[model samples]
Target: MNRNYLLNDAIISPLGFTTSENLTSIRNSETALKLHRNSRYFKEGYYAGLIDLDWINSKFSRIGNPGKYTKLEKLIILAIKQVIDPSQNFSTRSSGLVLSTTKGNIDLLNNNDFSADRIYLWKMAQVIADFFELKQKPVVVSNACISGALAIKTANDFIESGRFKNAVVAGGDLVSDFVLSGFQSFQAISSKPCRPFSNDREGVSLGEAAAAIFIDQEQSAVGESVHYIDAVTANDANHISGPSRTGEGLYQSISRLFNNSGVDPSKVDYISAHGTATNFNDEMESISFNRAELNYVPVNSFKGYYGHTLGASALLETILTKKCLLNNELLASHNFTESGVSVNLNIIREHKRKELRTALKTASGFGGCNLAMLLQKQSL
Candidate 1:
């Protein structure tokens, strides 16, 4: 089997458009989440990190026609365009596209003139694939918020199985009336920016983001000291909208990841957890981490900075984690003051220097879906 490495990546978020810009903002502890009093989704004001459509249009117009692209489509195309180098030559026939999102063009249905045909996830995948001129048929993964991480895992499978030499995994989602109303109905929308693992945390702040990663087997295509170690997924099917009370799926996934790879949980220098700031989600993760003996590891959630970007959260967080590893710095888990969950966790409170050789990324979405991935810094 061929080895997989995260070759290149780009992120289009409210913090910034490029990866470096976003990293700089993260290092400074700056958050893009803001209170929106005039949101189109709710009558009451909500907090979220929304992308400026005008900025996206202006940036996209320079490369492609803006009049023809939807909001999500533009974001995906721009993110993908940023990571791919014009000088690098690769056979399109052996490279494919994997699009990840929970809802694709579902917001399009909110408009009266929107075509129903555009709401199909496959159609959205095709549009992105055709734009990049990928030879293989595109793959779409929409398994809740775990979609992004699953996309990366699926891409690695394709490459290792000799089905493809490279894969561009892109994940994106927008906060719209459809999504906001659903979450609001569930009382999951926080009135302010989310404070994951905080004792007085309310709920989640919806955010929008688009991120893409280029994964290939060629070590030379990627730089030194960064490669995917493992990706494991599990599901407990405990509920459609809630996590398992025992954290069964997450614990099992993490345990399997370490066991299969023969890596110890204590070896992980940092953990990017799926801390949504919701009552069940945070508590569930606390149980899972402790159950897996990862309680002593330094952990943090980016929800307070970016809010919950749905399907894009994992991919976006993974990209930022890669930056953290490269810089030997750990990002502060913003807005966390006191431990809210039942278990004790070494939550990061400040940006500190550390030698990070291995990192674990975990996410638990609706339907009890859990995913764990291991990233290792390699030596050239």
Candidate 2:
């Protein structure tokens, strides 16, 4: 196999914690988003996706130094334990760890006045490595929201380069006062959950989660076959924190994937957009689609299903996209009743039944970085 990034396997998310549980949730359109009334900003309350802390908490009463870890990291470490245990696959010979988090310990700092220097990025990576005894120094990617994609891409590189035989990339973040206050201060937190692409759109609701995937270069038959990271990380230096107004970065990234993979853009059946439901993000993404000649690709975002998990946001969405890619079933774009952006786009409404051979993922973040990853179906 001459493939660049082969995603030999993946697990499901949001619902049905296992791969089967998550697939059943999507097939039935059962949403994990709930009405969050206990938040500081929500005097009356708004809907959001929250992992059942108490439930999962009781299960992980044994992780050492759980107090030092942020709520997000705890959740992620627990999730990682579910997939990776020291007894079976934690050997230091071939396995490696890659951790993704935007506010690694920012939440901890906000909750307590800890020294900022103590919040070094390397510490977060070490926590996971020690927890599982993988012994390999983990690579941390914290490029704002694109951290998860970056981590996955980094893991792919490690495996392809023969540095490791199996690299587990885990993405996670928790809803904390630091992020909530920041979004609310910017007037971006929706009073209601959010109405992405709707005529009565407000803004995005903050969400928290931990999603992990095991990417082994060795092919497996049990998990669904969604090729992992076939194409990734085409950078665009367009803006400091927002998407390129003209989508040049997005265009270039998608173009690079197609050109390098020899897969025509026209062959792509659907797209999982960064659809944050914000005005600029939606508008700029539409323009990027047009510029990339992908205006026709049916686009959807799983953000509606799970607020946005900062570091885990892209990872959660990527896993969902992989599920859809394997099942030949696409998710509804959700919350798009009208086109608010400059260009009219194909927003998936009902579940799309298409032969999704290849699905393109487009994501941008603070510091003007754009990423396009083309994931392909398993060969027949």
Q: Write the per-residue lDDT of candidate 1 for residues 34-143, one digit (tens) a residue.
A: 87876566777889899999999999999888877789999999999987764153456778788899998888886754456778999988888788787899899999
- Cα lDDT, all candidates: 0.88, 0.72
User: So what's the TM-score on candidate 1?
Assistant: 0.97
Pairs that collide in candidate 1 are none
Candidate 2 deviant stretches above 4 angstroms: 1-16, 42-46, 62-69, 85-90, 110-118, 222-224, 234-238
Q: Total backbone clashes of model 1?
A: 0
**TM-score list, all predictions:** 0.97, 0.88
RMSD of each: 1.5, 3.1
Report the lDDT tens digits of candidate 2 across residue range 1-380. 33433342233334645556666776676766678778677687766776676655554677655455555556777767766653243356568788888886676574454445536668766766776777677878888888887887888878778887777788777777777878777777677656566666677876767778777765555554767645556555766756777877777778887887788889888899888787777777888888888888888877776666678877777777887887788788765677788887888888867787788887877777778887877754
